[model samples]
Target chain A: MNIMTPTPPSKGRVDVDNFALSYDTLEGPVEAVSNASIHVNPGEFVSIVGPSGCGKSTLLNAVAGFLKPTRGGVTVDGEPIDGPGADRGMVFQQYSLFPWKTVKGNVEFGLKMKHLDKSSRDRAARTLLGLAGLTAFENKYPDSLSGGMKQRVGIVRALATGPKVLLLDEPFGALDAQTRVIMQQILTNMWQRLKISVLFVTHDIDEAIFLSDRVYCMTARPGSIKAEITIPLERPRHQSMMMSSEFLGLRRGLMSLIREESIKAMGGELNDLALDGLSIDLHGQSLADVL
Target chain B: MKVETFALRREQQTATGPEIGAETSHVRTVQSPAGAPPQLAAYLRRWLALNRRGLRAVLIGAISLALFLLAWHLLTENRVVFFIRFTNVPSPSAVYESLTRAMQDSTFFTHVVLSCRRILFGFSLAALIAVPLGLVMGRFRVAHEILFPVMEVLRPIPAIAWVPMAIMLWPTNEQSIIYITFLGSFFPILVNTLHGMSLVDPVLVRAAQCLGAREVSIFREVYFPASLPHIFTGLTVGMGVAWVSLIAAEMISGQFGIGYFTWEAYSLVQYADIALGMICIGVLGLGSSALIRGLGRLVMPWNRT
Candidate 1:
């Protein structure tokens, strides 16, 4: 179900050192995450899973330098994060591909920002597009592509900058189930090839387990890490492997952690899918993509 | 809950339905075309079916226009309309003859070229100023705060009302007319461009930033293009306004141009020349608007696909 390949030399190591984030809403100061520490080793794939309002995305945003930490700090390769930079590439849950640009243009945007010459930028963009099976659609706009295709382009665009770390915030949440699976496979393939550090934020336990070497489960509002579960499943994951005993055990472990936190956060607001707790009966139920 | 079950079942059906429908459609499409002419006929049938609504709309529009023209002809030529009497209005045939005669006249060409030059100059000048101003105002709160109030005050005033002010403000009558045209188009273009820039998705901005674009780069790559569709909307609207105001200005202030020609014809009581002038303005307006639309299509390649 999984195949481990020889790892490439690790280039990016992300360290979230007791990071905390808060927002000043109309109501007052609201803490989103507090004292959340996580380490992604070089070439490691780590997923942060949590309930609604659990600030998993907040952590990812902090790492991406989109939000300032309230307490501790995030660093990439020993450099303290300040603002957004090309060193950390992020793919949002929303397909953020520039509508005006062709697929190639969007992909080459990062390269252009780095002041890469025209020929090299084109070569790099063409290479990534080919990697995503979108070389033929280079001239097409983002609007013309399917949701999955757009997200794939999003990933390639992030990768084109040759960033040391790739940050994903529920990248497949918008896609259909079949397409989601396909994208997961494509992402896994790309991750294996590039061997860049990945900090994935997702709500789906299965997706977290499927994609990451370790999964960090966060508590609800005033969010912080509740549990860190190591996914012992081998690399190069296949869709069929999701049904395996190891995968199910890991999913069940993560599910109970999330259910407990969600029940506390919502207080009987948990629907049947959430109420099902750790059962596999909720498979294909189309639960909320967020939270 | 029952709702969850229902939703899951519906999703399953929709998911499976497309696969089955696609397979059958593929087979049917392959089997349907038999011979060359038959295949061509089938292709045309498909094309017609796809564009049936558009074709119907065109047909309806043509019929309405034809009916209106017929009514106009009957009313003016025979003076047979129930409530309205046609006294000064020329018959359609007389107007047509005048139109043909005007088309052959060198004076008509001079009038047309002069008016076009004035419009092109003013419109281009307005666009040159408005587009960047709008983008800046839309992008920066400080710029917006400073400009928004002034623009709002000016936006409601009619372009014709600017006639006296424009005349006093500019040295020559021609410059004043151009200024009036500029005033007519400027607000619409600026307002629409601002709206478009504001409507640009914040996610696109964030995505661009994450990809390491600085402020200028983000504006060039994201804000400018994102606002283009709205900008074109403004351009077309502004063009129409520019023409209307251009005519008014030309009639009031000029000795040549179509607007002056038409006003001169009306004063002389030559209804045929008046009709000819109206027709020329209408044709030119249509052509210019169509040109703007063509430019819009050229710039926004994403919209075409």
Candidate 2:
């Protein structure tokens, strides 16, 4: 994955070109992301892995059209994204399902918004909920469900409108490890079945490596794309693949990438610390010096 | 042979094992008797569980009323040191007798009906106007800025203070009393509805927008439902205030109503009728508030869990 080589953009591909986003605070304009660029081809699964405060979420928000980039633009399917559109759906980490709506009602929401009649809305909700194995709990409120179940409903609700791209901001970040793994499998299955583009944001290195076609590592604030690594694993990934050598290699690579950014962000001297058989330092030089 | 048969049955039961297990773990199911139909027994169990709480509440309430009655009897019987304020207050039995006598009088029905009508009309008018205004004020900054300061100034002036203005504004005494009642209830409902609308989760709004909901739909689906619990709180508080204003207005401008009856009784020095009037107002207020709470629970099923 060469940083200099641009991904071949196609129709329905999400492209962020030289994207820089900032927030206007009382103190000053604080830079969140700077000159960050990434692209996801149609039906490709991409994950952005970074340290805390690396602006991974800010970048994803820019894609979701919740926030406008200060410098660059985000284009989806060859069109500039002006605001939140139905074609780009989002799943949040907090399982932002409307608590007032039942599981079926939450899933039916997009269709209802699309002005689909009651029967078709019910059919669509039933189909999606059944696919997610949430049929039994259709009438249950979100507060009564497990965190994993709620997140599944969140996913279905996002997918209910049949969006072209799914922007997931740490969708499984709040789940327990076991549930997180199960949810990952469920997501993988859904993505495979639907063939939708995904731009997942996460701090978990293993999650990024396990779920993504390519993992993009981001530096700390003012954040920029640091590296991109291709995942050579085959699709329809299994839980057992986590123990394989290639998976472990990718995991180790992403962990170190995140660690370097985290230390640099902390203003740590980055003097040679004991790591996995590698001595690296970024004392006075830039992130590229060590990479 | 018997053991083999048992194992065969177990295997048959578990043929749909994984799916059944998943379903059971995911859905909270109540266990019921296997052979017999559990509908009757289930209904009975639920009914009993529900009424167990109700029964406890009723028992405690009855005991409390009895204690109050006994204390009232003792105090007015002129037997207690605390009762010796050269007591002119009527005894509990005397009040009870007056209540019975009033129940027999047809004028009592007129008084009760008139008071209830005024409360219902005034409260409905207040809610009709305030709820939409509050929602608009809360959603838009400019509307809030223009209206909130005015509301703050008006909210402090007690409903009793509005009686003179209401009398001057309306031609009839009935209209004036209703106006005063409306003024009393409008602020609580308005303030509460605004609070609820403002406190709606920003995350939910963003999620709704991303899910293809337009602004109008978002307000209808997300903001409206989100504000319901708070609206119910406002309704309950507003109902109470409506009753207070109604009584004050009725007392000030009299023809009929429990408030007028109570004031008339006080002037006539019939302390027993005064006590009865107070009791009637208390009972009606308690009932209405309870009804509002029940409605709130019905509307918000998620809040129950």
Best by DockQ: 1
Alpha carbon RMSD to native, model 2 = 8.3
Q: Please estimate how well model 1 matches the true structure, expressed as its whole-model Cα lDDT.
A: 0.87
lDDT of 1 at A80: 94
Candidate 1 residue lDDT tens string, B1-305? 34445666665566557554566534742222222223556657888999999999999999999998887788787766466668668888899998788888899899999899988988999999999999999999999999899999999999999999998999999899999999999999999999999899988898999999999999999999999999999999999999999999989989798999999999998899988899899999999999999999999989874
Q: Pairs clashing in candidate 1? A: none
* Highest TM-score model number: 1
Candidate 2: residue pairs that collide: none
lDDT of 2 by residue, B134-182 (tens): 8889899999999999999999999999888887899999999988888
Provide the lowest-lDDT 10-residue window in model 2 chain A. Answer: A1-10
| Docking quality band of candidate 1, CAPRI definitions | medium
Model 1 agreement with the true structure over A1-291: per-residue lDDT tens digits: 011233344668999988888879999988888778999999999999999888888888888888989899788889999899888999998888888889999998988898888888888888788989998999999889999999999998988887888999999998888999889999999998988899999888888999899999999888989999998888667888999998998888889899889887786656666566753454565566322
The per-residue C-alpha lDDT of model 2 at residue A253 equals 81
- Scoring the B chain of model 2 against the true B chain gives a TM-score of 0.82
Which residues of candidate 1, in runs, are more than 4 Å off?
A: A1-8, A268-291, B1-38
